[model samples]
Target: MNAELLARFHGVIPAGGVGTRLWPLSRAAAPKFLHDLTGSGSTLIRATYERLIPLAGGNIMVVTGRAHRTAVIAQLPEVSDLDLVLEPEPKDSAAAIGLAAAILYRRNPETIMGSFAADQVIRPVEVFQEAVLEAIHTAATGKIVTIGIRPTLPSTAFGYIRAGERLDISGAPTARDVVEFVEKPDGDTARRYLADGGYLWNAGMFVAPVSLMLKHLERSEPELYAGLTEIAAAWETPARDETMDRIWPNLPKTAIDYAVAEPAAAAGDVAVIPGVFDWDDVGDFAAIGRLNPASEETGVTVIGDVKRVYSDNATGVVVTDSKRVIALIGIHDVVVVDTPDALLVTTKEHAQSVKNTVDTLKKNGVMDVL
Candidate 1:
């Protein structure tokens, strides 16, 4: 967040994904957000939160489920019992966000909360802040705001936001009216969307006034609104835990796009702001591999040093859980990942598909590996 924008906003981290993609190392108990996938000094969740500390002090909120609670508690030292919005069950984005709004409302009714994925990487702090400031300004005008990054490639993995007319917001980047949200498009469609202009990669980063989000829920998802409202009201006295048990179990297992965003977009209450920041949602290993250090020969940036030396590739990322060394005698364009229970070796182009290994392992009933 920008310094000026920092004056009146709180940060919200939705750190509740099951992280099935990064299996073997990332388990059901310890999700991807809690793992040190970056090889940097911090976990994805922690680093993401640290980036927001300039804007929000100790008031950050992490919404999580029970399965990963222990790991979240173990991983995030800055977190306290009160700082978490622990959902009783694994409700999707809609419920998780609804829960965050209710809790933030209890603390500060008019708080402006910025939503974070806790699994993305955006460089140059200035760009991230500019994007957020623009979104906040849009939110201030009663529009639910989400940042849209200019797509570098036609990626089918991420959703798309069709950007439209620009708005004037001082100290903010280009703010555009979102025309429509197109869910993950196929390669051909994605390429057309990118080439056709007015399309952006949905960053999943959002900003909204707590009251505005609550109002959106009230307008679009009244049952969820009432259910979480009941949960919040129960916090007043002896009925707190009881109410969560009743309502949280029934929350629709739907993403925010399905729950609230799509409805708001249908009603033309959503806006997309240009996020010219260097951003990447490190959804899988290949994405994480891109963040590796530079090579000695060509100064080519690479991740996972252990395998790079073996393959002799300038921009190589190699990881191994072998107590012994992992050497790439003569290999190129290969990714080698090793864990105590499993090993993965693939070409960089196919690294993202490595998630299929996880699914096969699950089908094989190898619970310990996952």
Candidate 2:
């Protein structure tokens, strides 16, 4: 990696989202990003910050909800106050990431920014860093770059990116033109995409010049761009809080993919760098089971006190926050999460449907547990 190139890079982490699918463990007060879902000792957000520090050094910013301000600061004490961008309300990724880009652009127009989510698990840090370096090198050419993960399975859970002809960039040998961003397809379509071999999972990771990011935002979403611009202007001044409070709630809500990536790809301005590293969003309990190591004797993956969880002829994931002992017998593929106020019991096959339970609780006016 070039020292000069690394000096020009800035990393932005978007850390909002309650992760309803992993409910009971992931709550609005403390989302999945704050927890050690992978049993990796470090929380997801902290790990994400560590992963970027090698490339961006102290030039990193975290964009998250105001509700999580204290917790985020506690987990990432290295993040300076000025580097933490807090939104009064969740306006999705577009506002969160675009605001960071606008502020970086204002600070230094030549800055290359990379946006990585806070609640993802990526392994072999060196591989991920290498791919990000390529992304940065490609972004320096004035094109919006996205790091697309090589799909390991026909997973319908994630969006897909179509890679076109390979590009001939000076420092980015594996860079390629992105044909299009495809939404999550049906099972059959996902399998077909896997067989076709031209598709990569859209990991929502992006690298681009701050100026180019803002240019796309200005063209695709003028109103949002204007609001972010006004806020960025006052970001370094005493009026930062005043401007953010006044304009943040009204900004349009959308993901960076729809707001920037897709449009840029259509305009022939988007490129992709293949990420060969292992990546997981940890969407539900099944993912949690997959990520954690199972006990040899019990065949049960435990996130809490392993001794407290007893199992016989069972295989599943168990997470216990309380001291109460949990025992399972003659069960298969189960997911049991025992929190202080709530207990969730479901099968791994239906793990994705846990969001439906959260919806039902909201409809029933059950806000205490939520």
The 10-residue segment with the lowest total lDDT in model 1: 299-308
For 1-370, candidate 1 gives per-residue lDDT tens digits of 4555566688889987666665555667767787666678678888888888766777688988877777777767788766677787788888888777887788777678889987777788777876777777778777888888888888999999988788776645578777888889999999899898899888778788888778878887888888888887776568776787878888767677876777777788888887787887776666666766546663333333344233343344556555646666455566666776677777668766767877887799977877
Task: Assess candidate 1 and give its lDDT.
Answer: 0.75
Count of backbone clashes for each model?
3, 0
Taking all chains together, each candidate's TM-score versus the true structure is 0.89, 0.99
Tens digits of per-residue lDDT, candidate 2, 248-309, equal: 98889888888999999999999999999999999999999889989998999999654499
176: Cα error in model 1, Å: 1.4
Quote model 1's TM-score: 0.89
Q: Of the candidates shown, which would achieve the greatest TM-score relative to the real structure?
A: 2
For model 2, the stretches where C-alpha displacement exceeds 4 angstroms are: 305-307
